[model samples]
Target: MLTEAEKAATLWIQTGFTDRTVIQAAVAEPLLAGQSVVGVAPTGSGKTLAYGIPALSRLVPGAGLQLVIIVPAQELAIQIRDVLTPLAKTLGLGFQGLIGSANRERQVKKLREKPEAVVATLGRFVDLLEERKVVLEEVKTLIVDEFDSFEPDALRDILSFRRGGLPKQANLGLFSATDNPTIVSEFQAAWPDLQVINETSTDNSRGVVHHLLLDRQQAGKIQVLENLAREKHQRVFVFFNHKHVLQKVASELRFKHVPASMLVTDGRQVQRAEALQDFRSGRVPLLLTTDVAARGLDVADVTAVVNFELPDTLTTYIHRTGRTGRQGANGTVYNLGDDHDLRDLRKLVGDRVALETEPGEKKAYRKSAAHSAGADETRGVERQTGAGHRPGKRLTSAEEEAASAKKRKKKKQRWRNKKNVGKHW
Candidate 1:
């Protein structure tokens, strides 16, 4: 007889239309059978289902919420919700989303009702725990998605929930696409006998083609962007280091007549959702964003990725570029950088990325900008501007002292003449 997990896996395969071998294996033999498990797989590797299938399979129908998935961002929570919600419905399981910027009152009410599963962000989950609005006593399985992204404070808050008490034999699963050596080592040290599943080396090389373009200046970047936009005509994701830069890039693209939208951390939930939908539907040709959209977003049909500014970490770079080349599709990543960035690019991707030279015209200095032969254009008027005519001229120290002395002498002479006039009076 097939086990409950097997039954769920079969249903998932039919509904989702892909066979996840590792996920199936994990479900067949759960990590909590005496040990913890950490799965390191790249984006679009069906990680959510890897943990979700086993979690939902373990749930008893009509029981209280027993599973919780903690993600890094609210957008990711929603993405996971969208994917797992269908499976939950198919299996007749109830789930609730506990992310930020949602109806907190409704979430509190739902917690009282006790759904079968809860997907949430770390901060909001901590808030709920502090408010006593949600109890984790019934949670037998906890999945922390993108564990590498969790800061020390958030991790402490997560551990604090145990202060209230935890399940006797609760299972913990940590999943991430990029592996941070320190974080992975720390986690392993904490749980000495944890099982690690690595599927990155095999999966990363099979699908994507990475390209690194060495652009000397902003003009070169704009030129490359325009070329790619016209050629691909597919959903493009452009990443920047700052939110303001994302906004600026989006605005500049729009000004250049490129249909672009932005996704940043400061936007409202509905606004982010609408922007994502617009990009996914091909209504927006370019999607400008920061690292907020780098991880856990499952936008289909992203054809190319442009790194307007490279991220500081290798994990960030991988996740940013992972937006494209999904699901065995032939996608391209263009890294736009100046000469100073080439060394970092080489260290991150090695020789895997093809190096392309900037155009000659792009490298050549502009003749128009060089000092023209005759008069200079000043506020649309011709002026004989030169080094002498330029503002901020400074006097020598000696010249300054002599001018002061002359003024002092003239003042003294005027006072003496005034005294003589007084004597004559």
Candidate 2:
């Protein structure tokens, strides 16, 4: 029987139409009614607890792996494991992470001992499944967190696990920070009657101020970054597009004596984890990263998000900017781009944000004068060279005409040579 607190929690879950509200509703309604359920929520919205609290409340005392949460990155798996550990302890439920970077032998050994809930990434989870190391037929709940990041291939691998034949009405929860229309539509088509609770509006209540910096050249952008870094002195996340560019920018900052670190996918797992830890612990004030840090990973106390290089896609832009201003903190996003680039970004952000120009600044190209000077020099060269002659040389009209006649004679000779060679062959 559900306790009064749990019942109230369920009621709270059902009342709001936000992402968190919807998730609470799904968890409570299904468990209360003895039916399986799925809950979809945004990133950083306490998704782990939304499903975890209910799963723990409903689990049999020593049941093993009754709930399995699959995430895209190892960082997310570790994060989920951390969130569930205390709750599991209170409920006397066992929990273990089946992440890739961790010791596989140890994970398998832990599995041998039978844990109640297992959090894992898709690749490693599939590996365990293929090895017959985990039995999912008894899995009461399967929560696929960040389903949008799960490519079709990963989803296919997950669907194959159903071959083990789970209960006819097992709970399936797909959670994401983004409510991609295409993903939602496809998901509904697949499940037909899957209940969806849109929580994007509520999830965005975390107090993030978005800004776009336009008409800034690469040099000017670097200056802005330096100024902001010195002024804020808070932990910052600078997102870039290419790995090479990420490293290059970090190197440039270091050259300028700026304390900065970088996290890229190509680095070893330990290195990446250390970078993240340093940034989170505030030892490193600035973190330059690729999209590897954009999704699912949680880093509290980030003061600002600097898009050193703008993301090409809207989803990516949202995720990048969403990193800061999390948990109701007043965080700002600085989008550094040229005018053309800002236009593209504006289209992505739509009317959600208004573009504001920096006050007391005139929009002018500093290189225009230099370009005109170069054009004048080229014209001077042309005047010296005369009409039919190449630049950098003076030629009289008679010399120019003679040169043209000589060129024509050479062309006729070349054509004759080609014709003779063809005839002889």
Candidate 3:
């Protein structure tokens, strides 16, 4: 029951994105009829093709740049361009992969040439807009991919583009696998008439991901990741919250002959190119990165994702693990963090985390992760005691009085509750 254009669209997909809900929903009249779309679909669910096909199909070649795609990271921009550029060339449509590290002068020259589409990192795109006379007057569609993970810099560039010379009538689309309620609220408030399309799997996770936790310190976590990389084959994305930690982990891995590379926002172009080449070609087996690679970065046979540190929020956790277990394929994710991280994860996702407690040596690992759910009250008490306390100084007059009063009040409240329970018993 495919229309001619739909059939043509499906024919262009080399990645076998033929039977996805996103593709169907995107091509429907509503989306093509200028209804701004907020597509919340699972990772590896053909989200790129869902929007890309329709966007490309609407392209009138040589009509000055018609489509503008904004991605959060440089690598994402490069990856999307890799997917769309060939298809564009096939259709006689021109597009440019605009990146900051790449030749900006050449990119400007391409902008002057007015490619039919521009897949750009938010920072580079903004810089180009300032330095060059790029025309957005002919732009008809605007796409912000990975909306949740957009950094402050990217968001700033997007706000400027939204309020700047770009036509108000341009079709707008915001897409990501992770749904941030705050961002969703903001988008809805901004575009009251936007059509919100959610095809995210009933269970947010796609593959048979093992929601696991490794209760280890920072050094121990690196060792665990190394063990995973050496044991099971294929690429592994080891994520750290801090860049310093990421680099340190990578250095340790390399120092121990584990061939680890750092993939971060500020990584050099040559390094990025080599890292991707090695990853795709199986030359480099392990990549240490920050949240930069969390969303929409595709590498074949990335069977697992390792969280060197548990992400701060549930949204981040979902996306980080969503990297693996994509497209109904089986994958695994191992999260490493302290007791609080494990507890918070249990609270947020419930039993979605299938913490693996293997035989032999992993018995203790299982025990370490056992009390995650029940440790909440204890953790809370620890936080109150250790938070913001100076190492070698007594509390000031005001602080001493406040601390004593607070402790007294807490003690009294606990005794009262305990007495009440005793009376009932």
Best by TM-score: 1
lDDT of 3 by residue, 168-283 (tens): 77887888886667776766665677777776655343645555554555544654555555553667888888988887777777765677767777778888777777777877
Model 2 Cα lDDT, one tens digit per residue, 278-303: 88888888888877555677788677
Candidate 3, position 413, lDDT:
44
lDDT of 1 by residue, 308-358 (tens): 887777788778777777777766666776655855776776654443332
**lDDT ranking from best candidate downward:** 3, 1, 2
Residue-pair clash count for candidate 2: 3
Report every candidate's CA lDDT. Answer: 0.66, 0.65, 0.66
Candidate ranking (TM-score, best to worst): 1, 3, 2
Deviation in Å, model 2, residue 164 alpha carbon: 3.9
RMSD of 1: 17.5
Model 2, position 306, has a per-residue lDDT of 84
The regions of model 3 sitting more than 4 angstroms off are 1-17, 21-29, 202-205, 351-425
**True-vs-predicted CA distance for residue 366, candidate 3, Å:** 9.1
